[model samples]
Target: MNKWIRKSAVVLISVLTFGLITPTQLITNVNAENPSERDTVEGARLGSYGQEASYFNEAEVDKDKFIEDLVKQAEMQSYQKFGTRIKPVIENEFREIVMPNIEKALQEIANQFPTEDLLNLAITESPGKGQSEKIFNIKNNNTNTDVLRFHVRRDNPPQAGYWFNFHYHTYHDGFQSHHELGSIYWDKNTPPKWMS
Candidate 1:
């Protein structure tokens, strides 16, 4: 009975956290200052309440799989759009900017709970073997709006689509780390915010 109640409570809270509580109520309750829109629920986007935060119990677990995919996709998209010219710069950024921060995020999560080695596997697999050819097809929650970040070699770049996160969970996660050296399609149920 206790376990059942706990589970039920979790579900209820998840629903409540997502705007499932009530639109009129949500607008009145949640504030604009909130960040990183919940991704686990329907209509979840950054900076507001939605599904993602609902199901997410810090105690439940910490597997940043979604973030991992998004980061890889971001890197690949940059290279794809820029070709060889911009690859070096983007690749450099991947090492300098992407890698370190993701590592720190993983540390934070790990310190909080007993993750099943997801973060370690992520780093080892991604940028690990330098299987740099793998491409991740990351799309946004809304099909019409894809979170694609393209790095133009020298000049202008298109200003369209939601600035999506590189991976759904974190950079270089374990779930899809073993991606073969080819094309991989990632369908995002909830998208992350893009970094400018």
Candidate 2:
């Protein structure tokens, strides 16, 4: 039958393609039973590929959930060598810089995609209601690096405005903070350049 031949051909093509693909090249679903390193890390820190250019489509993303996760993660990252607290880094950055810029960016995305309510919601709910106070229990369980940014230019809109960076080194042994200004942006015109 024609259907049988078509199915056989499809299977052959799939098998061939699978053999050619590398482990890193294969995209992982975020909801998988054993999530990939990319899926486990926000923005896919280990790999050069970002969630912006995810091969697997995400129908919905909850911004509040993301923010909540970040807050809980902050707690676990509070203490490092000599029982020093890193709570200030999370609270200060979230309130003063990260949240505001994220809000502005969300507004821009909302304006661009009026019908895409989920996108707007994802941006809006990023700033949580309150701060976490349990500093002692804040463990260093996270293995994914996180980078937060603040707008440099207030006069202009969020999309094209200047920015500052606040990144945490979670992949290594201790929680290291790195502050620098990098040109990381969402280009509506061009597709994301994912790693090969």
The TM-scores of all predictions, comma-separated, are 0.24, 0.22
Among residues 3 or more apart in sequence or in different chains, the pairs in candidate 2 whose N, CA or C atoms overlap within 3 Å are 75-138, 76-138, 76-139
lDDT for each residue of candidate 1 in 1-196, tens digit (9 for 90 to 100): 8657655655666587774455443443343344444422324422111124444344533355435443454444444533453344345645565455544543454444344322222211122112232233222332323222121111112543222223323224434333111211112232221221
The 10-residue segment with the lowest total lDDT in model 1: 148-157
Residue 160 in candidate 1 has what lDDT?
34
The per-candidate count of clashes, in order, stands at 24, 3
Model 1: residues with Cα > 4 Å off, grouped in runs = 1-63, 98-143, 146-196
Off by over 4 Å in 2: 1-85, 116-164, 167-196
Candidate 2 per-residue lDDT, tens place, 55-155, comes to: 22344344444334434333333222102232332345545555454434333333443232322221111221123211221111132322232222112
lDDT score of residue 114 within candidate 2: 27
